[model samples]
Target: MAALRTKIIACPTVGEELRSLLPDGFVLEMLAYGLHNVPENLHAQLQASIDATGPEFGTILLGYGLCANAILGLNSRRFRLVIPRADDCITLFLGSRREYLRQLSLAPGTFFLTKGWIECGEDPYTEYCALRTRYGHEKAHKITRRYIQNYTRLALIDSGSYESEAYRKYARMVADYFDLTFEEIPGSNELLGKLLSGEWDKGFAVIPPGQVVARDLFYGPEGMP
Candidate 1:
């Protein structure tokens, strides 16, 4: 028998850059019904649907009003295309950095992309630390290192951290791989929070408008949202 291809379809968040990133083979559509609050009752239904559907790609959608706390039942693979409205900084970088970078680069943009401080402002290295905490620092850093190798250029702004000197030193290693620039500023978290939450109201988060604002939206030092 031939190897099975992954099934890829689930709840969608309406509008977001990631929608554009969906592969040609995958199907994109809204959930069977609107999720008022991550629908606790739907966990079994979702799991059953995913299991019965036997999706090779197994993606689940996250709609507006669905809080992360609502559905703590989901594992990493509950949906291949899991779209959590509010995810931990570290969780975003769970995959290999090189692979993630390649995936990100292949997505549909070339201009400068920015993730607001709401996601990275927690502790400056909140995402990095989250990754390390969840997957270990060495592993997370290794992944970052690998991804850095593939990119020919990188420009970083360390405005999120109060410890500018430390960020500057770390920027050197990243700079060794790609051209890097570090800016020291405080309150990146606050800046990002406002931007994504529509306080600034002129950002990517507003594209697929109508969803809970994140305290912090995690991605990378100089990466996509």
Candidate 2:
């Protein structure tokens, strides 16, 4: 009999990107975006998804970064859990933990955007539009301002995972609305490819069956995770 395909549990943003890159056959589960805002709930939902998929696949490939440590304590008794050594989607988008940090150091107050975020309608511009509908323009503007107090730049990352000019335009509009400088950064799928290829080197945390994901496992220096 052929081996069963792996199951993928991913953040919706990155999950969308994975569609084109993942092999022809696999089970995919995409959790909603912005779960980073509610780290605890994100953890619970992911743990639940893992449990649900455990019996179905021998391996579960998590298309997520360290993700605020949300995957930290998840146990896998019936399957292996594999995740990239990244703090969040930004690292996944930017290619590696080093590049993500390089951008942060170069512009600490940047709001990063990706094709996945735009295609999924999870950008701040989407939130702003919804707020405008619910709270009216003035109130929405105020709220948006308060929400973006620390951010000074809006960066759209194209990781060569997907391409869309409309997404680029929308991100530019967001920059104009917020009076933040807009920048375009090239993204890479190097690490993302590694994740799918099961190249579980130090760049990935490969939790064997019957073990749990620990914070420390995701906490090492990006080079030797």
Q: Give the winner by lDDT.
A: 2
Question: How well does each candidate superpose onto the true structure, as a TM-score?
Answer: 0.28, 0.91
lDDT of 1 by residue, 1-225 (tens): 543343333333222222434444544444443442345655544545544554354333433222333333443333332333333222122222233345345532211112322222322243455577778878876765554444443333333323345545554444443343332222123322332223422122221222332333323332234
The lDDT values for all models are 0.36, 0.82
Clashing pairs in 2: 66-86
lDDT of 1 at 15: 23
Runs of candidate 2 exceeding 4 Å displacement: 54-56, 220-225
Question: What would the TM-score be for candidate 2 when compared with the true structure?
Answer: 0.91
The all-Cα superposition gives candidate 2 an RMSD in Å to the true structure of 2.0
Which regions of candidate 1 deviate over 4 angstroms? 1-4, 9-12, 15-19, 55-68, 75-225
Candidate 1: lDDT of 194?
31
lDDT of 1 at 220: 30
lDDT of model 1 at position 146:
56
